[model samples]
Target: MNNAHYELQDGIAVIRLENPPVNGLSYELRRGIVDGIKKAEADDNAKAVVIIGSDRAFSGGADITEFNTPKVMAEPTLPTVINVLDSTELPVVAAIGGVCMGGGLELAMGCHFRIAHPQTQVALPEVKLGLLPGAGGTQRLPRLIGIEYAMNLIVSGTQVPAAMFQGTPLFDELVEGDLLESALTFAKKVVEEQRPLKRVRDMKVSHPKPEAFFLWAKTSVGAVAKNYPAPLKCVEAVKASIEKKFDDGIKLERELFAQLIQTPESRALRHAFFADRAAGKISDVASDTPTREINKVGVIGAGTMGSGIAINFLNAGIPVTILEMKQEALDRGVAHIKGVYEGRVKKGKMTQESAEKKMGLLSTTLSYDDFKDMDLVIEAVFEDMGVKQKVFETLDATCKPGAILASNTSTLDLDKIASFTKRPEDVIGLHFFSPANVMKLLEVVRGEKTSKEVLATSMKLAKKIKKTGVVSGVCDGFIGNRMVGKYQTEALLMIEEGASPQQIDKAIEKFGFVMGPIRMADLAGGDIGWAIRKRHYEEKPDTRRLYVADRLCEMGRFGQKTGAGFYKYEPGNRKPLHDPEVDRVIEEVRKEQGITPRKISDQEIVERCVFALVNEGARILEEGIAQRASDIDIIYLTGYGFPVFRGGPMLYADEVGLINVERALQKYRKQTGNPFWEPAPLLAKLAAEGKTFN
Candidate 1:
């Protein structure tokens, strides 16, 4: 069946787009629109034409599922359908409501006239997928609106209300209510008045100081989009609008779009986009699984992590009761929560009243008694098993039956944590990244004993709190932390050999990470890693110790908190400055180990660090710790600041070719003689078979 419905309403030919859930313009939908336009043109009873969609979306643009598929470029493509609309002699009015983005807006621009709901969200967000609008968006948008406004919308990929374009030629009318009625009336009026076919291509586009403006735009966009080439291409496409004729401008836009599609940056972005969506789906857990209600939440501890966790639920409008051991600690936690809201208000992100309203949902106490009625209780106490045991035992005793007992443990085993509670079935892990309120990733650890209902509820709650929840089976560090351990180990090993912290950081940062491993370690606090290493010493004595990091901890150069780490931080400043003292310490440690310093290449640094992650990730996939390779990618993308333009380690390895990655691992193994440098079985097998991680 066609994805559109055509009918004669009054005297207007109404062709309503019927693709549900944002109405992505898939091939079938594109074909339906083309057929409807033909039918409208042939009908004698129809006065004019109106194209409409559901209340949720006018159209959300090209179907992502169809990307990299032949169906995306099938006959009657989005551009072809829009060409039909442009050619039609009869007045075609786009009655847009809800989301009208990318090709949807491009399609609307092709029509004779346009009317939209004031609240409709409009954008050309193709830039986010490392692309410019390929279907006449660049050529037509500047013709409707000015160059500056159109360029800003396309390059930034931000959404704005359709009302923002009310006075512009982009919208003929902005209706606040009953969009269909207004559209039909507008269509009839167009017919009665014999309005000429108003194609956007016929309109003139001009800009003041066009040369200067485009030059500045290119430079600015280039700086912001340092690694990715699409944003700069977007500027070029927009520049073509005024520099060339309409058809010629569209040709340039298509050429640039095609070039970007072939780029690895664009490929990686598309992979990440699909991987993010894939991460939410569990193979064994049915999408329609019933989830337990989580209306009231109880948080144990009032430290930074605990407070951040509470803020998330409070922001989501859930009532929270935060418990602490002492009243002073409780007061401090409450103050921290208040300060966060106050800061938001000060930044003009929210109203003071709104902040107060959210804070009003918080209840602070020093007793487990307050958690009796909580639907869910998450313990964000110290990451000690003994402390966790006490907290869970108390929560199990105090919380109402069936209340989910979740632990906010980053590295501890979820199964062991579940064993602490009597209702192990109600236990799950909700591992929030540092600064929990702002981070996007939440590893929803599905313990062996965790009920499907509880697991589903945790996933649902992750979405409710606006987090990208990637499910991980219980392991020492789950997926992200486990892989990162190997990544950090390689970085430390490089530093010990010859590479300075600065060189290692710059290499990885250049490789597209937001921050380098050494900088991240310093910012996160050297003490934290030291503690983890101490534990590793007891648990796995055979594991090699990172002596340099241990020596730094001994020096009490904790991090930004203590004002000194691998690099010195000036008071109130986060910039990492070179310290001669740090260099001296490194040299001393190297001497003690009877190791001679040798120059290491940046390429070697990047490979050792990133490949370490890929190797561990392969093991993670083999062990089923991560359900799929894409899930691991999501963890790194959302949690670990992995470059979105390189996809994630797994996909990056695939792009690098697993054979090349295995070769690099072998090279490292022979040079370093480290057992950990060995390629994972999965990686080796995939390389041998000439298969990708996918």
Candidate 2:
């Protein structure tokens, strides 16, 4: 019931923040801190006040639950609470441990003294949410530490250990012992010595060559600020700490925070922040559902995907046994994993001893017998159904009774794959993105018959392996690929209609995609999309054709692997070069189709490609393929290189306005005469009602 507890011991008053998970400095906690300080002031015997929190967190930051609500800016706001602590006559000591960040650090700096655990994670992470620290963080931090360190910490939103600031005024003492004990002893000393109540606001912040330094900071931050304006604003706010008085700096910080939060870029980043957390929850599955243990993992095949999957388990300290059809293949897989660890070692990302320890958890096998003891077996074999069927059949017979049988199939029918095993309830799809170990997405495909227990465990395992697992119902290509198909198709169609591959790619990249679809196709190997299209041509005879892509593949131009596709690459260099041959090929296809090429604007290119994804994502949401609109955003943001600032295609569509999106779809549908451009029913409905997806 009490968010903060008040106690008195030997003339010392202690205010212990009691919010669980993380003392997030909620209104209640803020009031409690103020009330405790008041109580300390009133007590004749209380000589000093000590503020503390649990070892897990002195405070993580602002209470995210209160975000976007009036509660966040209610009376006794973070600044008000900090101001209370700052003006208090008695010396206040902040005993910080574990995580203390954002307004939490601001609160600590408001105190007269700070004693922290050496490993306490300290940060002013508001810039990550597209805002500067609004509560004296920029003003006080530069005063405690130098301008340079404060600039880096506030702008980057990166966490540094308290030990890193050992000799700095940020932490009066870095304690390796019990935090509260050190704080109580320090408070006693402060009382005995009658120490002055130090205020960070009174401290001066100076920077040599202030104008030149700030000019360089702006230029450096500008280069990476991209579509997000928060980083540069952060620089401005930090510079103000030196240029302006303390209260004036605080006012400037508030102004910048307000301006940044209202920007579309900041809104998108905030949406993405919430969307990632939302993806981890499954509505039908209770949070308390029991999950099966996955102490040992078995990975089928020894190719790139399989080896990468095995490395995830090995890195998680879970023993992984990789099965390959041949000993030579097994040897190559093992060697590839070793080389990856060796690369990390050489780069100093990890020590050789640590790499060796991870490798020690990895073992190779030639048969399924080794999988019997595996609690979870993931098959990363060929994507063909026949190949998957055989792997599932073998695993069905080989793995133990409760073992989770997962397939890393990207587009295959998960239900059919599950049918290969009698225990269909245990079969689920753990679709890892390419370079499985590197990419963050893991689409946990929940089949028609997947048990709740298995689904819960699969989600848990995804987190354990450090992947953003988004749940998807059974559907061809599931969520990410299904939407990406439309995205890439629009790009190809634009090329057919006259836009160059480079032009289309540049437009999308300019819109903030990590890579353009045409360049992405080249990087992913054009043959892969060509093969899928061939399958589509057979399965859906009336499917819209992408002739130019097929013609390029017909010429044996796969991608970077084949030294050419839509673009050519120099040996040992991944940069794609302009291939005049590809231009000629595009012309030939256009002539064959009797299509007249028209110059397309970059705006058209971006809208067509991005809105194509938005329309398909609408359909996916309508069909219940994706749990919510945000899940689609998460999949695209993490796996498909959708711009985080745009909050992925779905959220971007909402930001663009559903009615506007519907209008664009109608315009493109008529202009292009492509049936795929037709607005999805849900999109039209939402637009008619003037509602957003999220």
**How many steric overlaps does candidate 2 have?**
0
Q: After superposition, how far is residue 456 of candidate 2 from its true place, in Å?
A: 0.9
Q: Give lDDT tens digits, candidate 1, residues 1-694.
A: 7998999998799999998898899888999899998898889888789999989999999888788789988899888898999988888999999999999999889998999999999999999999999999999999999999999999999999998888999999998789899999899899898988899999999987999999999989888998889999999999999989988998999999999999999988888888889888989889999998899999988989999999999999999999988999999999999999999999999999999999999999877888889999988988788888888888888889889999998889888888877899999999989899999999999999999989889988998999999999888888998889899999998899999999999999988899999999998889888888899999998989899999989999987888999999999999999999889999999999998999999999999989999999999999998988989988999999999989999999999999999999999999999988799999999999999997
**Runs of candidate 2 exceeding 4 Å displacement:** none
CA deviation > 4 Å runs, candidate 1: none
TM-scores of the models, in the given order?
Answer: 0.98, 0.99
Candidate 2, residues 249-274, lDDT tens digits: the string is 99999999889989988898889899
Error of 1 at 267 (Å): 0.7
Worst 10 residues of 1 by lDDT: 390-399
